[model samples]
Target: MTVSPLVWTLTVALILGMLVYDFVFHARKPHVPTMRESAIWSAAYVGIALVFGLVVLALWGGDFAGQYYAGYITEKALSVDNLFVFLIILATFRVPRQYQEEVLLFGIAFSLIARTGLIFVGAGLINQFAWVFYIFAVILLATAGSTLKEALKGDEEEEGDSRFIKLIRRIFHTSDEYDGNKLFTHLNGRRVMTPMLLVMIAIGGTDLLFALDSIPAIFGLTQEVYLVFTAVAFSLLGLKQLYFLIDGLLDRLIYLSYGLSAILGFIAVKLFLHALHENNLPFINGGEHVTVFEITTSLSLSVIIGILVVTVLASLYSPRGRAMSVVSATEMLSERYLQLPADATDSQRDAISRKLARQLQRMPRISDSLKDELISDRRHYMELLHEVHGEHLDYLSARQSSDDTSSAESAELERRKTAFSDIVNPAAESVGSAEESVGSTAPEGSSEGRPQHH
Candidate 1:
């Protein structure tokens, strides 16, 4: 169905208005959303999406509505996969918990803008060339294969070491520390890019890459530009809240990659069939359309939902999934503890330590069932946890004492800090030490001799 210019204009305005409202009312203040807040807002966005779908059904007929739902569901599932990378990026940067909301909102907004451009480009390609479907089919098929391979290998690519991020770092003078939500800050009497900006760039770049696959996958479901644009926009609208709601549970969905692979592979077949049905290449079938099987939108939606349901249920019930969740939770809590600022309150420290301790207590029960590699990793992190716990105790003791610490106590504290830093980020620690050594050897009055605060 062709959409009118006025309808398109209104739709774009509504999406942009919602984004503005979200930023002004919700994300303007940097704060970690409570679980209840995340849930409520997430459901609200979903409800709005569903209500809009019903409006489509009333005006555009059931066929168009089915296409919209299928496209929306596919895009939403792909967005969940995107979150895995987002979680890694945030953790790698050690973004402050309260300020994560701002970063996520920026990422979401960037994703919408980036994907909207790609969607139009894809539509243009489809309009101008019938052979584009074949290309899209191949892309989806290859992506599915690679996704499955990674799932089988049980390895995730480190987003922190991406070449794009490396290029950005090499091109810009970046400060290691974040200056609140600001992208640039004054450091050493000069302005420098902050980690906050780097992370936002990282997320935005990753979102562009994610769009390459997701756009093709959604187009395979429906070629209508209106449905594609609205589906994708609504899919991303609630993504930030969804991230918070499911962040802790993400690791438990061990079969997610497998399910995504299956979904993409199914969509690939659909696109291939559609390509054959609209064949225009002279080399194949003498440039004539072939009457082959076509997958209906309703069938696509049903299959996608079925696969997701089964995937979630299997992951939740599997023994290994439980073990992996425990390990992941332990690692997350440990990193959060280490990432806490020097001025963190005692209650903040106590909360994380208590959670880490509980995760540690659960580890022994699952240790016998874990693979050797995981067991080794767990052991390594366990040592780090013990050290962190010891440091916490020392900090509490120091706070309790009203007198100044002796040289020995101060040295001991420094040693523990170095040890923790080495365990968590050895490369960074080594680099910092090298810089410190260079500074120590420099002349006293030289700017190079002044220690830089990270």
Candidate 2:
């Protein structure tokens, strides 16, 4: 498939423009995005990707279009899987909700650069060496096995940092605390790295590892480097928005890991088959054409879409998903309500109040009276926090005034000491000089004769 330079330039320009708009409008300010805001932007991005796919379908033949869609869907599924790790990383870092978007945006940007390099290298290798597919297939198979093991164990939390993060901590003086989304901060007059920076590094490293699987999986579906790159790019474009849109919903998708593992396993088999068909190694089938059943792009695309739809539906209806959804919802609501600023805007307060009311109304397990009481208790908590904050300010002011008074008194004492020293030193010297002069003039042999009479 031949793509014109003009098309490439246009695509790059458009993607760059969207990124600029995203930074300027969505991520420019630090705020927890509203459900409505997240939904709109996420839908917009998905819509844009679908429209671009349609354009590809019209320009290229159905075969190429099928390849693009297959690659896009596969990459999209992988990206969602990537989201879980991102969530784990964010939670581990205890990143502030407002700053989460900024961190995600930064991670996405870094991954784009790193993944682009990987894409080129992978493309080059595949073009040069047919046996490279075997390596990609083996890696994907191993990843799928590992993913299946973890999924079956039902372990949700990614407990600790990777080797990359550990190395970063060991080599750099990193703070355990976040400095309001800043990657670097000054401590005791020395600049130090913050957990945010380490989190970004970990995120980048994690994505790079995922690329090992994803790059090969997409290549298996389509050999065209352009399709692979665009599919990956389009899939990643709005991931930041999707992260917020499904922040809690993501936790409820308990079966997603299994679905992803299955997809990876299927793709790995496909890659292995493709490698055998294009065998160049002398040992493999004596360099003969090992004809095998080739998987069609349409079938691959259908299977991927079908798996995703079923996984999503089953996850939502599953017992665990239902139980955890409510628990997670309540936890998030309680946390958000408590952290609501005392000086929050009227609209902000009203929004929270309405959200709480809706949740209470929807929740069947909790009583209406209890919900009402809970809401009132949150209000009381806010008031208490405000009162405490005022008192803290007053105490600080009082301490500062006491310090100022003490400093002034200390200055006055120092001045008195200086004056006393100036007068006393001179007088003592003068007295000593007078005594010396008197003894020298009148005393010598006369004093000795007078002492005999005494």
Candidate 3:
């Protein structure tokens, strides 16, 4: 069935409208979404996708609808897997929690544009050559094997130091600290790219690679360009909300890669069978089409759904999964707490410190080596905090003694002093107590009375 240009235009317009709405209404003001907010918005986006799938059913019949659902599911699962990398990139850049929404929304919009182009290109390739499926099969199979290997090796950390990022760093003057959510900021009397821009670039580059895998995978299910484009777009629609909703539990889904590998491998086999049915290579089968078993869309959907259900259940119940989750959470919490910006509010710092303390209490459940590492990290962070606190005190004392100190300077000093005494000092003391409780001694010269120098 051919879709009219009118229909395509309307569809594209609608998707773009939604993207604009998300940007203007949700991500315009940077704020950390609460659990309730994340869950509600995630569900709303998913519901919108489902309704569009139903529209496909009404307009193009059950067959096209099945294809759409299957393609959407596969792409959505792949998107979830990609979120792990997004988490790493943001954490590596130490993006402020409030500003993460902007980064994610930009990545999603960029991915949609890139994938739409790839979808049309893929369609053209299929129309011109019968051998493209073979190439797609090879790609999916290779990706599947790579994913499986990674899954077996346990969680490996990504430093977001991809060659592209390194190249960008070399080519552009970049700022270490983010100036709010701006991609570019003035530092030392000159404008420079901020980590905000670098992280977005990392995500955009990742999206391109993801499109390479996803376009072919979806093409394996259905060759209809309209369905392909719509499926990919809808899958990405609510991804930012989904990321926030699942980030805390991402490490808990230990078997997700295994399931994705199985799905990709299954699609690869299906693609190979389809390719055989349309064989045109002269070396084998005499350049004639070969008839073979082809997997139906219904069966493909069922298999994908079944694999996901089993994977999620197994991961949630697995003891090892729980342990890994705790370890990852601890590391992330520590990093976030230690990397809090100089202008971060006292409440924000207190919140992170409380979370870190809670994670510390669960330290006994993790491996001894990991626990030791976390303990050392906490101790080092405490010493740094003490040092910063002392510096703030000195600044406050100097300001108090200066006769020219303005009201604004006095007010700022009071705020800093309150933050240090109320949040910073208590946080450092709590970490010290946690370390002692875990049978680790605090480092020498880390006591409150000790004078520390930068």
lDDT against the true structure, per candidate, is: 0.81, 0.73, 0.81
The candidate with the higher lDDT, 2 or 3, is 3
lDDT of 1 by residue, 360-445 (tens): 55655564436443444533453444445445555655654536777677666566444433343332222134443333332211
Model 2, C-alpha of 149: deviation from truth (Å): 0.8
Model 1 local distance difference test score: 0.81
Stretches > 4 Å off in candidate 3:
155-159, 334-454
Clashing residue pairs in candidate 2 are: none
- For candidate 3, the lDDT comes to 0.81
- RMSD (Cα, Å) of model 3: 6.7
- Per-residue alpha-carbon lDDT of candidate 2 for residues 1-454, written as tens digits (9 for 90 to 100): 8899999899888887887788888777988888899999999988998888888889888899899989988898899888988988987777878988888888778777777898899989999999999999998899889899998876654633777678878988888888987889988888899988888887877877788778888888999878888888888889999999998788678788888888889889999999999998999889886999888988889888888888898889865566456545644654555565656564664455445444433444534343342333433333322222222233223434464557766565445334433432232222234343223221211222111110
Model 3 clashing residue pairs (backbone): none
Model 2 worst lDDT window (10 residues)? 445-454
lDDT of 3 by residue, 1-454 (tens): 7799899899999999999999999899899898899999999989989999999999989999999999999999999998988988887787888999999999999999999899999999999998999999999999999889988875554647788888988988999888888889998998899999999998898889888899999999999999999999999999999999998789788889999999999999999999999999998699999989999999999999999999998888776666656656655665555555667675776575566546545545555454354344656645555554454455455665579888887787677556545554444555555544233322222334533432
Q: What is the TM-score (0 to 1) of candidate 3?
A: 0.80
Q: How close is candidate 2 to the true structure, as a TM-score?
A: 0.76
Candidate 1 Cα misplacement greater than 4 A, ranges: 341-358, 367-376, 391-454
Output the number of the TM-score-best candidate. Answer: 1
Positional deviation of residue 374's Cα in model 1 after best superposition, in angstroms: 3.7
